[model samples]
Target: MLEISRRGQAMPVSPFRKLAPYAELARQQGRIVYPLNIGQPDIETPPAALAAVRNADIRVLGYSHGAGTESYRHRLAAYYQRAGLPVVMEDIIVTTGGSEAILFALLTCLNPGDEIIIPEPFYGTYTAFSIAAGVNIVPVTARIDNGFALPPLANFERALTPRTRAILICNPSNPTGYVYRRAELESILGLCKAHSLYLISDEAYREFCYDAPYVSALELAGAEPNVVVVDTISKRYSACGARVGALVTLNKQVYVAAFRFAQMRVSPPGLGMLLAEAAAELPESYFDESKAEYQARRDLTVARLQAMPGVVCPRPGGAFYVLAHLPVDNTEAFGQWLLESFSYENQTLLLSPANGFYQTPGLGSQEVRLAYVINRTDLAAALDCLERALLAYPGRTEPPLTTTEVASAFTAPLLTQLQ
Candidate 1:
C-alpha cells in the first residue's frame, strides 16, 4: 500500500472549506445557499486595480525577482511607511499570498521541534502551517465573556516553554474581531522583547479596523529587528484572486532567510505584482467606503445574534467576523444540519463550526464563527435561516443567558466605547 506520510495525515483540514461539499449538494437540490462560513468578501475588486493588469504591456509574463520586482516593493514599502512603519524595498520578500507569507515566516523563524504560542481561536489555518513547519503550537485560549480579547499577558507567560521561539498575533483578529488596542500591543511587544522572541504580526485586516486605529508591529519603537508582518492585497483591496502578499521585516537576516524560501518557489504570480503595485497607489481615503460597509455588516450581524433567544454575541471592536455562542450543545452537528436537513423557504446557510478553530478539545463546541462578508440582504437571510434552524434543531437547549441578559451585558461596554 502506498502510505501517506505522518505529516500529511497530521495537517488539520480547514474548516472554512471542509463543508463545501455539503454546500454543493444544497445547491444541487435547488436550495439557495448563502455563505457565512469563510472570509471571502463579496466586495468587488477595485476597477482601477483590475485595469492595471488588463493594460499591462507584457510580452512575457515571466518571473519577477524573488523579492518581487523592485518597482512593486518600492511602492509597497512606501504604503507601509505612510502608515508610520519605517520600511524600505530591501526589507520585503513577496510570496504567493498572505498564506505563503505565513509559511515563510514560520519556516524562517523556527527550527524543527520549536514551539510558537498563539491566541485561540485564531485563523484556523495556522495549525496547518505549523504542522508543515514541523513546529508545535501552544495555544492561549481567549474567551467570549470579554469579547475574546487576547488571553491576558499572564497567560502567554505561563504557556512559555524552553522550546518557545515566537508569538504570533492577528491584530484585528479573525474569528473574534477583537482588535488589539495600544495597551495590549505594547504589553505583548514588551513581553516579546524581554524574552528575545520573534513576533509575527499578521495585519491582513489592518485597513478594516473600525472602532480603533490600526497599529502595526513595525511601529513599535524597538520592534525593528524582532517583528515580521504578513500582509496581503487580497483582503486589503478585495483582491484575493491576485495571490500577492509580502513578508516584511527590518531584520536583515530574517529578510535574507525568507528570500531564499521565496526563491525556492521560483517567483510570485507576475500579474499579481502589477495589480498589487497599482492597488498600493490608491489613496488612503479609498478605504472609507469599504470600511464603513464592513462595519455596518458587523453591526447587523451582532445585533441580529444578540436579539435571538438563547444566543450570546458580544459586539466586536473591528473586523467583519463575530463568534457567536449558539443555543446548541455542538455547532458541528448544527452546522451540518443547516445544510443537510434544515432550510427556511428553500434557503440554507453555510457555517464554520467554532470547534475546528480551537485546538484544545471540548472548547468552542457551542460556538460558530460568522463572516458578514455578504450584502445586507443575503446576510439577513442567512441569520433568519440560523434562527429557524436553532428553533427546529433536535439538540437545541436554552443558552446560559436570556436574550435580555446577553443584550444588557453588551450595552455598558458598547456605550462607553461610543462615548
Candidate 2:
C-alpha cells in the first residue's frame, strides 16, 4: 500500500465543518439546527449580478485568459481604486476564490522551508494552505479582552526569524472580527519594510466594518511591493457559490509569479467573473444597506453573549463574528454536546470551536467563534439555545464574570485559566 504524503496527513480538519456529522444526526432526529458555525451569510445576492449570468449570450462556456478576463480585470482595478487601493489591470490576477489567491501568494513568495508569521486565532484555512505549500506558520497570540487587537509589535518581532519570508493578516479578521486600525497597519508596514517581508492582507470582510474605518495596506504610502491583498466576492456580494476572487498588488514580480500559477489552474469561473463584474458596478447604497444589516446582527450577538452566565465576549469592531470565551473546559466537547444532546424548543445551534483557529496547543479551548450571518429571528433563537445549553451542560464549571473581571482575566499579559 502506498503511504500518504506527510503534508496530506497533517492537514488540519476544518473547524467550521468538523461537527457536521453531529449536525446531520440532529437533523435526522427532527431538530431545526440554526447554523452559526460557518460565515455563509443569509443576505440575498445582488439582482444585477444574477441577471448578468442569466443574460450572458455565451455560445460556448469557453476558458478565459489565465489571468482572468481582461475586461473584468480592468473593471476590478477601477473598483479597487475607488476603495482607496490604487491598482491597475497589470496588478491583478483573478482566481477561483480567495482561497486560491492565498495559496498562490504562499506559493509565490516563500520556499518550502520558509516561514510566515501571522496572528493566532486566524482563519483556519491558512493553516491548511501553509501545510500544502510546505511552509511554517509562526503565530503571535492576541488577547480577546482587547477585542483581539493586533498583537504587540514586539511579539511579532520576537516571532520573526532568518527564514521568515512573509507576514499575513486578515483585516476585519474572520473569527475575531477585530479590524486593524490605520496606526496598527502602519506599524506592521514599517516592520515588513525593515524585514523585507511580504504582507498578505486578506480583506474578504472589508466592506462590513461597523465601529471603525478600514485602512487597506495598499493605501499606505510605501507599501507597494510588500502588500498583496486577497479579496473575494463571497461575503461582499453574497456570492460564495460563484467562487470569484483576486490577488491584487503593485509588486510586478509577485504578480508575474502568481499569473504563472494561475495558468496552471487554466481559468477562473466564467459565470462567476460575470457576477463579480456586475457586483463591481453596484451602487454604494448596496454596501450601505448590507453593512447596516450585519452591524445590527453583531450588536444583537454581543448583547446576548454578555447576558449569558460565565460568558465573556468583547464587542467586535468589524466583520460579523465574535469570539466568546465560555465557562467550559473544552469548547470542542461542548460544541459536540450542543449538536448531539442539547436543544431548546426543538431547536439547537451549531458553532465552530475556537481551538482550531489557534495553531498553538492549549489555546482557545474555552472559546467559540460565532458568525452573525443569519436574520434576527434565527439569531435570537440560536442565542436562546446557546444560553440554555450553558445552563444545562454537564461540564459547567463556574459562574459568569463581571465586565471588569472578564477584562482583567482575558486581556492580561499572562494567559488566564479558569479557577
Alpha carbon lDDT of each predicted model:
0.88, 0.91
lDDT of 2 by residue, 1-419 (tens): 99999998999899999998999999999999999999999999999999999999999999999989998999899888888778999899999999999999999999999999999899999999999999999999999888899999999999999999999999989899999999999999999999999999999999999887889999998989899999999999999999999999899999999999999989999999999999898877889988998988888888878877689999898988999999888999999999999987899989999999999999999999999899988888888778767867778779655558645543444211111
Q: Every model's Cα RMSD, please?
A: 4.7, 6.1
How many steric overlaps does candidate 2 have? 1
Which model scores highest in lDDT?
Answer: 2
Deviation of model 1 at 83, angstroms: 0.8
- Collision pairs in model 1: none
Clashes in model 2: which pairs?
Answer: 310-400
Candidate 2: residue 164 lDDT (0-100) = 99
Candidate 2 lDDT trough over 10 residues, lowest sum: 410-419
- TM-scores, all candidates, are 0.94, 0.95
By summed lDDT, the worst window of 10 consecutive residues in model 1 runs over: 410-419
